[model samples]
Target: MDTVPETRIGWTFLTNHARVLTAIADNPSVRIRDIAAHCRLTERAVQKIITDLEEDGYLSHIREGRANTYRIVPGKVLRHPAEAGLTVGSLLSLLVQDESERSPQYAHVKQ
Candidate 1:
């Protein structure tokens, strides 16, 4: 019997903070389940990401009945000193490719 090596991809390369920011940028009203699915992460992971983003001033949420509306602060600078003064928009552009240019697996989910 041969054992296969575990390989990590995509979201694994991103910090939870970055993932949540990207998820919200992709869809402000997106649910936790949907974000987890899209990001190839777990619901708990998504929830934690959201919490971290909110705590760090990168995101804010407003309760709207059964759903929460998220607002991203695009002007917020990244944490790294080398990345200081760079906005969330700049960071997201580097992390996420446009929908039309993505592979088929992600094409349908592209905005």
Candidate 2:
């Protein structure tokens, strides 16, 4: 009998920064705890990443009562030379696709 892998490999195409950014883009009012949960990172780690992004001019946030509402700088250019001229808006558009919003039903589909 064959078994499925329960854990992911050590690496992926996107970095933790990208994942954190993606998570925030998914929900502007998302909590740090929620972002940590989604990104498989510790709350401290997420907080540090948020700081880095803010320092680099990629993101910002404002306190709304007890919660924080994030604001992404969509016009900021990406870091890599290869992605030169590409805006944060473009990256978020690709990562936050409509398909991701739909509940997946792949279990019912045959391989």
Best by lDDT: 2
Candidate 1 lDDT over residue span 26-49, tens digit each: 667778876776666799988888
Candidate 2 at 47: error in angstroms?
0.3
Q: Give the Cα error of residue 37 in candidate 2, in Å.
A: 0.6
The residue-by-residue lDDT of candidate 2 on 1-111, one tens digit each, is 012225487878899999899878767778888677667789999999999999999999999788888999999999999999999999999987475464432233222
- Assess each prediction's global lDDT (C-alpha) against the native: 0.73, 0.81
Cα deviation at 29, candidate 2, in Å, is 0.4
lDDT of 2: 0.81
User: C-alpha displacement of 42 in model 2, angstroms?
Assistant: 0.4
Model 2 off-target regions past 4 Å?
1-6, 99-111
Q: On a 0 to 1 TM-score scale, where does candidate 1 land against the true structure?
A: 0.71
lDDT (Cα, 0-100) at 99 in candidate 1: 68
TM per prediction: 0.71, 0.81
